[model samples]
Target: MTDQPTTASPAATSPAATPSPLAQLPGAVGAPTAEHYGDPVAEQRALAAGRALVDLSDRGVVTLTGPDRLRLLDSLTSQSLAGLAPGSSAETLLLDPNGRIEHAMHVVDDGETAWLIVEGAAAPAVAAWFDRMRFMMQVEVVDASAEWAVIGAMAPADAEPSIPAAAPNGHALVWRDPWAAVQSGGWQYAAEAAHPAADYPAVELIVERAFLAELAGLARAGGVRLAGSLAAQALRVAAWRPRFAAEVDEKSIPHETDWLRSAVHLAKGCYRGQETVAKVHNLGRPPRRLVMLHLDGSDAQLPPAGATVHAADADRAEVGRITSVARHHELGPIALAIVKRSLDVTVPLVVPVDGVDIAAAQEVIVPPEAGQSAAVPRIPRLGAKSR
Candidate 1:
C-alpha cells in the first residue's frame, strides 16, 4: 500500500469539499479517495465473486430525523417515502422544476433516522439544499458524511445466505438495491423481459465512523478481499445502472435513464419535477436516451470519460458524449452514454480519443419508445359528437 501523497483532487479542495474516511487509507489518492489500490481488474473480479468488499465510503450520507421526516421527503422527491417502513430501502431523485436530475439518494430509515446515501461529489451541495428547503418542516437534516463509512456488497455468492444482501445486521444498516425490477408503484420504461439490472445484486452497509480503520485492516489482512471503485463501476455500467454523477446532465430527465424503474413513483402525490415527468411520459419524448457501448477491443487504447460520440457513418452528426467508461474483466472496454433520441439504433457508433476513433456497438438500454405506457386519456370537447 502506497502512502497518500497530497490533499485531494482539484475538485475536492475547492470551497465546499467534504472529505471522506477512506482518504487516509494506504495507496489512497484522489479528491475524496483513491481510484483503486493497484489492481482494478482483480478487485473487480473479487467483487463479482462475492469474495470481496469495496469502499463506497467516498459517497456521502445524510441523516434525516424528526417526526415529519418521511412526510417532508415524500413531498420533495420522486419516491413515496412517507409510507416506507423502517428497515426498508428505496431510491429517489431530486430534480429541478425542468426535470433535470440534481441529486439521487438511496434511502433507508432506522426508525429514528432516515439515512440518505448520495454521491460524494453532490453531498455538500445536497446537504445545503436540504437546509434551504427546511421552511416549516419538522425534519432535521445533518451531513453525517464524516460519521459513517459505506461498505458495498456485490456479487455475493448465491450459496451464502448470510452475505448481507440488504438485511441489517447489528449496527450496520444495509440498503438493498431495488434496481432489480420495478417497485410496487414504480414503472419500467424498457420493455426487455430480462432487464440487465436484474442481474446486478448490490447493497450498501453503513457503519459507524470509528470502525473505518478496523474494516480496512481486515480487508488487507485477507479476512476479506478489498475491491476498488472500478470493479463496482464496471458491474454498474454493465447492468445499465443509471447513476446521477455520470448519466445525468443539466438537461437530464428521469425518462432518459429509465430511472422510473425504481427511483420515481408514478402514483405519488406530488414532487418538484412530477409535472415534467408526467408530461413527458404521457405526451412527449425525452430529448436523450441511455445506451451501453461495447467498445472495440482490438485497439489497446480506451476512450476516456466525456469523449464525444459520433455515428459510424461518414455523414453522421455528433450524437452524444460518453459519461462513464470502464474496462470490464469479461467485456474488455465498455461505456455508458446518453445520446440524442433520434440517433438510429442500428447504426454503429464511434468515440474519439486522442485523434483516434474507437468503434462502438450500441446496445439499447433506454429505448426510444420509453414512457409510452403512460396512456394519456383523450378527452373530447363538450360539443364533439360520438363517432
Candidate 2:
C-alpha cells in the first residue's frame, strides 16, 4: 500500500494533451462541469466504441491478504472462493444471516491476495464488517478505497490499440463482473504520489471540461438524449440487475435475490449464513418475487417509485409495488415491481398515481419457480373516460 497526497487535480486541459481517452471524464459527481453528456444512448455508444471512458473512481477498493485471505473471504461472502486462481475475478455477495445482501462486490484474486471492489456508498460498512469478523483469522484488510482510481471502458469485439498491459507492481486482472474485461494496476502521479490505477490504461485522455460538454453536445446533435436517474434505474431493473438496498432488503435471502448463480457457491462447505441459506433452499419458499412491469393506459404520465399495485379483478388487494420507473422514448413507460408470487398473473394490476390509473402488467423475468412457469402479464387499460 502506498501513501500519497490526497488532493485531486483539476479536470484535464485538452484532449490532445493526454495519453488516455479515459482521462477526459469527471472522477467525481457534481465536479465542475464545462460540458455535460446529455443522453444515455450516446454515452453507451461511446463506451461500446471505446471512444468514451466512464469514471468509476468513486467506487471503493479493499485489499485482503495473509494465509487466511481466501478462507476468510469464503466464510464471509456467499461465493465459493476455495479454488480461485490468481488473476481471476468473481462476483460475490456479503449477506446477513437472514440472507439479505449487505454488499455486492467484484473480487479480484491474485493467488495469494484478493481485492474487493464495492459500490462507493458501501465501502465503510463493508470494511467494518470484515474487521468485526476477523476474530482469529490470519488476515489483514486495508481500506484502499482512496488510493485507487477505477475506470470502465466497453469496446466492440475489434477496436483500438488494445487494453494496455498490466503493471508489474501490485496489479491484477479481474474478470468477475459481466460488463468488461477489467484490469487493476498502479499509476504514479509524482515522485511522492503513487496510487493504484486498477489496471487503467497508460494513455491519458486530457480534455478541458468544455470539450467534454462539446462532445456531449455532438452526441445530442446526433440524436442521442440524456436519461434521468429514473431511466437508468429502469434499465438496470429491466436487465434483472439488483440494486443493493431496493431488491436486497434486510429480510432477503440470497436465493430470493436470485444471486446464487452469480454470487453464491453451491458446493462450498459453510459460512456464517450458510445454515439459513441451506434451510431456506430446502424448506422455505421465496417471499416476494422481482418482476418487470409494463404499464398501459395513457402514456403521458408514468408510475412513480413506491406506487402501490393492486389487483383490479381480485378482491382489490395489494399485490405489489413499483420499485423503479423510467420513461424511455422507444419503450414508453416501464417499471420494476416487487410483488407477491401468489398473485394471479391474469388479473390486472393498477398503479394509482395520485388517483389516476397507470395501467400495469406483470412480466416475470426471474420467476418464483426460477424459469419453470414463465409468463408475460399484459397491461390492461383504464376506462375510456380515464383514458
Candidate 3:
C-alpha cells in the first residue's frame, strides 16, 4: 500500500456523492443483521469486551497510489495527509466550494497505497470524481469496494488481524478512530468528562472480499463472537461519531457534526472550501449542530431515520430530525439528531412515530459555541503583530 487519493467531477462542482435512501435504511431478509447472532444485548456485551467481529461488507474501499498521492490529497481534503506516516490513520472531508460536506473518507496510509474507507452508496461517484481530478498527476485511484471488504473488530489498532493489508510499520492498515479526542490541529467542540468512544476501541481492517467470511468464521471458532452492522452502528452512535452515510444531509458541514475534532486540518493550506471552514471555525458557529436524543422507550418503538423532531408541549415546531437511530442493549432507544443551533438545548423534544409521541430529551453533542465566535475581538488575527 502507498499514500494517495473523490465525488464531483472536475467540472461538476457539487454533484451528489451518495445515492442512499433519504429515509431509514432497514435490514433485509428475516431479521435485522444484529439479531442474526442471537441477542443484540449479548452482541453489545461482546463488542464492549473486544470479542466481537462485525461484517461491514456494505462499506466502500478505494486505493490511491503514486509518489505524489499524499501531497495531492493534502491539497484536496480537510486533513493533512502530506506527512501521514505508514500505518497512521486520518479522516478527511471533501467539501463543495461552499463548504458543504460531499464526502468523508477514513484514510490509512501504507507505504505503497492509501486506502480510503467510504460509504458504499458513494463509491462509484467518488471514484469518478477522483479520476477527473487527476489532470496531470502521477496518481492512480481505483474503487476496490468489490474486490476488498471492511470488517470492524473490537480491538486495538496495533493488534494483528488475520490477512490484513500490510503496512511498513508492522501494523495493519487500520483506520484508528481519532474521535476519542482532539487530535493535532483539531478542536474539541463537545465538552465532556470523557468521550464515550474512549472506552470502546474499534479498528477497521481491509481485506480481500473472498476471505471475509472465512476470517469471521475463524474468529468465531477462536471464541470471538460475530456481530453485524446493527451492533457496529449502535456503538458508533454511542460514541457520537459522525458517519458520512448516516449523519450527512445535503447541507452538512464539518462543524455541524462536531467532526472538526478529527476531520479538519485547521492549519493546512488552501483547499476547496478552506475559506468557509476557516470562517466558520475562527469566527462563527454552524447554522445547525448535531445532538443526541435519549428517546422514550416505553412504547418500544424506534424512530426511523429522517423522522422530524419538534419542541415539546406548547408549540410543536420542527426543530431537528433524527439522522440515525438505534435500540441499544443498555441505552434502549437512542438516536442522533441534527437541529437548529438556536433551539434551546435544555428543552425536551418530541418525535412522532406511528401516531405516538416518542419523547426525546436533548443531549448536547455540538455546543452552541462549537466554532470560533465573532466576538473574540481581543484575540489577534493571523498576521497581526503584537506590540
Candidate 4:
C-alpha cells in the first residue's frame, strides 16, 4: 500500500446532505433510512443469491491514517492487526477492562489508510476513543461517517458491477465478513460440522456519500436493485452471525456470542481486557451463551429484539431474552437469543409475541460447555503422589 492521503469523491458529504435517489424508488418508505423497497421476502432471496444490494449507508466509517495506523490498532483492539495487509479484512472488538465489549469494527486497509466500518451510532465515540489512545503516535483518526456511506452485498468482493468502486491503489475498501470460518489465533465454539455462515458470504463496501445517488440512479435504470435492512438482517440471523448493534449490550463479552471465531485472537499479546479473555477461555465459561430459536410460526408474528424468552416448563421460568428476531424465507421465524449458560439445551423455550407464548426450540450456538480449552491438569492433593 502506498502512503497517500485518503480522499473522498467530490460528491456530497453526508447521507442527509440531500435526499437519496433511492428514497425516490417506488414502494420505498424508509429510503434514506432503512426500510425495504417493496417485498422483503423476495429481497432476502435475491440478496442471499447475490442478486441485490442492501443499503447500509447509515453505518459509520472511520479512517486511520499515517505510518502507525496498523500498529496503533493492533496495540489496542482484540485482533492482531499490526500486520494487516492491504485489501485484507478483519473483525475486531474493543473491550472494557472487565472484558465487556465496547465497540466492534470491520477493518480493511488500502495500504496508507485503515478503514473501519462501524455501527453508525457508535462512530463518534469510537473515533474519540481512538484519538485518546493515539498518545504520541503517528496515527491520525478521522470519523469519516459524514463523508462516506456503507453498502452490503452478498457477492465476492471482486465481483463486477455489484461492488463499489476501488481505491486509487486498485484495492477495494471492502470488509469481507470473516464469520464464515475461524481465523488464525481464533477459536470456534459452535460444534456444527457444517456452519450456517458457510452459506452467508457478505461484504460491506465503503463508498463516497454522493455515490448513493449514482447507485439509486442505477436502480432506477434497472441496472441494479436495492434491498433494505430487513432482508439483510434476516439473512444474518439465519447465519447465526452476531452483530454488535443487535447482539451486543453493555455487559456483552466475546465469549457469550461465540465471537472468538473471528473477532478475538486468543493467543495474541496484551491489550485491553486480554486478562479476562484468557481467564475465561482457559478456566471458566462465559456466564451467558447464544442460541438460535426456532419459533412456532403458527401466528405468523415475530418477536421484537428485546422480547423475553422463557423455559417451556409449567412455571414458564424466564431463561433468556431475544436479541434479534426475523422471519426467514425458508426457516420461518428465527431469533438469536442470549440465555444463562446453565439453561438446559434440551428444554424447549417460549417467546411471547403480544400476549401469547410462541413455542421455541433452541439450537445451541455457544454451548454451556464452551471454554476451558486450556484444560489445565488438576493439582495433586497434599501428600499424594504426583501422577
Candidate 5:
C-alpha cells in the first residue's frame, strides 16, 4: 500500500508541517495525511475495548428546526421521522429521482429539532438539495458543522460507566458497530455555545487537532494501539459496513445500496424521490447487492478496490468486483464487493491483486428478497452445507 497524504486542509496547520495522530500509527505506508486511516485493525480493537476516541469532526452536521422539521425531513430522507425520540438516531439516505443515492446520514431528533450528520465533503451539496426542495415547507436548515465537534467513542461492555456522560449541551447516541459499542455526540464550545452540563468530566478535554495529537500519545502510553486506514478498511469489510464511495455510486439506487430497508420510510408521505422509492419497494427490484468476500489464505494480500472478482473454475468469468479489502491479523484477508444478486454464493471467486491471486468467498449481508419485492433474488448461503 502506498502512502497518500490527506488532501483536506490540515484541520488547523499545514499538512506537511504538522505531525498527525495518523502519522503515529504503525505500518503507515502512505503520505499520512490522506483521507484514509493508516491502521484499521488496531483502531478496531481500541474501539472494541472502549478506550479509543476517533475524530469524526470531518463529518458534517446540519440542523433543522421549527414546526415543519419532522414533516420536511420525512419528505426528503428515506427513513420515517415521525417516531424519533431524543437520544436515538437512525441511518438514512437522500436519493435522486432515479433512486441513486446522493447522500447518506445519521438523523437524530433532540425532541424539539432534528440534526442530520453526513459525510464531511457532502454537507454543502445535501444542504443545497434540501433548500431547493423546501417549496412551501416551514422549515429552516442551517449548517452546524462549525458550531459543534463530532467525536466517536467505543467502550467495552464492562466499562460502560467509564464512558463519559453526554455533555451538558450535547446529545449522545449509542452506536452499535460490528467491532464495538460506540457512543457519539457533539458539544458546543464555540462562541454562543452554552455548556449544558455544569460539571461534565469531558468538558475540560479539548477536542481540537492538537488535542488529537495528545490523545494519540496518551493512547500509546496507556497501551491503546492506533490502527491505520488499511486496518480500518478491513474492519469495515469484516463488519459488513457499506462505505460511501465503494458501495454507493452515481448509478446506485437507495434500495440497491441496502440502505433503504434501514434508512428509508415506506410510510412517509410525499418527498422529492418518494415516488421512485415507493415504486421500487412496491414493484421493482434493486439492480445490485452488497456482499462480504472472505479471501483465502492467511498470508494473502486482499484484492485492491475495483479488481474484477471471477469464478475460479469457470474460465475466470466475472462475477463481481472488489470494493474494499484489508489484511486482518485475526480474520486474514477480507473484502466487500457489489455483485449481481443472482450469482450463486457457492461459486468460488478470485481477485487478482498485483501479481497475487486472492481467493474470494461470498457472504451475503443484505438480501434483495427480504422485504422490497418477490422478484428480487434470495441471498444464497455460502456455508449452508456445513450448517
Candidate 6:
C-alpha cells in the first residue's frame, strides 16, 4: 500500500545518498522498484502463490522508542496498543477531530521500539505529529526510513528464508497483514459469506537498507523470484484491502472504506475523533460507501485512479470516483470506488476513460446500511401482544 511512485524519497532519507539496488535491475521502471518486470500478470500469480517477493523500498519507516512508546501510541490511535506484546503486529488509524482519517499505520513492537510502516509521502508528517504530541513523555520519535527498508511477501516472515528477518532487539520486525480476520473489538460492514481477504496472507518484512543489494543479487542469481509494486497493488485491490495511499482522502472516515475490520477498536478509550466514530457506528451511516467495479474488459481500456464513475441509466449522473483500479490476474479489469451510499446497487455503472464509456458492474463492499451497531431495544406498540 505504501509503494506509490514519488519524485522524492521521504524527507528523513535522501534518495541521492544511495541508489536502491532493486531499482537498477533490468526492466525496473519506477523510482524505488520495478513497477513490473515486463510481465505483470505472471508476477501477480507468482506473488499470490507465495513464490515472489514485492519490492517496497518506497515505504516509510518510523520508530518510537523509550518506556512509554506503547502507551503513547495507545492514547493517540484507534487501536488499544498499550498492551501490545513484542513481535505482535497490528493496524491502527490516526483520525482528525471529526473522524476523518489522517494516517493509517501498520505497527509492530520489538520490545525496545515500536516500528511504524506508513505511506511514504506521509512519513515525515507522521513523525512530526508524534513529536508534537509528546509533552514531557518519556518517548523519542525518529524517522528511520533512511536506515531501514521494507520488503513484502505473501508468506509469513519466518517461512521466507531468502529474505532474512531483522531482529534488532531479540524480536523480529515483521508486520503481518491482519485483514483476513476481523480483529477483536472491531466490526465488519461487508456481509459476504466468504471473504476474499481470507485467502490473502501477506507480510511486510523490515530489513537493513544495506541488504537491498544482496536481495537484488539473489533475484538476479535466480535464488528468489521478484515481483513489483504493480503486482502487489493488484493483489491488495483484489483482497479489498483499504490503503491510505489509494482509498483515503481528506473527508474519508473509517466506516466508508470498511477499515474498521482491521484498524479500529470499537470499544477503545477516547482519542481524537472518538466521538464521531462512536456516533457514526451507533446512530448513523457513513456518507459514502465502497464498491468494487468489474469493468468491461472487451474495451481494453483500464480506467485510471480518480476516474469519474457515472450511472449508466438515462441522464448518466456522476455518482462517485474511482479510488483504485487494476487488471487483476484472475478477475480481469477491476476497480474500487467510493460512491454515494444511496446509489442503487442494481444500477449499472459507466466509467469514462479517454472519451469512451467503459461499462462497469457493481459489487458492494461497504453496504448502504453500514453502521448503527448499537443494541437499542425496539419500542412495543400499545396493542401489541405480550408473550
Candidate 6 lands at a TM-score of: 0.93
| lDDT for each residue of candidate 1 in 35-112, tens digit (9 for 90 to 100) | 676788887887877777777777778888887888878988999899888777899998777777878899988777
Best by lDDT: 6
Model 6 regions lying over 4 Å from their true place: 1-19, 156-158, 378-387
lDDT of 2 at 44: 38
Tens digits of per-residue lDDT, candidate 6, 1-387, equal: 231212234443453234478878887777656788889999999999899998887788989999999889999889989999999999999988888898899999999999999877677778878887877889999988888888998974346535767999999898898898899988899999799998888899999988988999988898888888889988988888989988998899999989999999999898888999999999899999999999999988899999999999899999999999999999999999999999999999999988999999999999998898888899999999989
Give one digit per residue, the lDDT tens place, for model 4 in 1-387. Answer: 321122232234454334456767778877455568889899889999899998887678889999999988898889999999998989999888888898899999999999999877677667777887888999899988877888888975446437565585679787889998889999999999999998888988888877888887888889997887889988999999999988998789999999999999988889988999999998999999999999999987888999999988789998989999888899989999999999999998888777888999999999999989896898888899865
- Per residue, candidate 2 scores C-alpha lDDT tens digits across 99-146 of 666677777776666777766556655666676677799888876655
Clash pairs, candidate 3, are 1-112, 1-113, 2-112, 2-113, 2-114
Whole-model lDDT for model 1 versus the true structure? Answer: 0.78
Instruction: Estimate, for each residue in 208-243, the C-alpha lDDT of model 3 and write its tens digit.
Output: 666655654565456445665677778888889889
The better-scoring model by TM-score among 2 and 5 is 5
Query: Roughly what TM-score does model 5 have, to 2 decimal places?
Result: 0.71
Overall lDDT per candidate, in order of appearance: 0.78, 0.54, 0.76, 0.85, 0.57, 0.87
TM-score of each: 0.88, 0.67, 0.86, 0.93, 0.71, 0.93
In model 6, what are the clashing residue pairs, if there are any?
none
Clashing pairs in 1: 9-31
TM-score of 3: 0.86
List model 5 lDDT by residue over 147-180, tens digit each: 5434554443334423343332365534322112
Window of ten residues with lowest summed lDDT in model 5: 196-205
Tell me how far the alpha carbon of residue 352 in candidate 5 is from the true structure, in angstroms, after superposition.
1.8
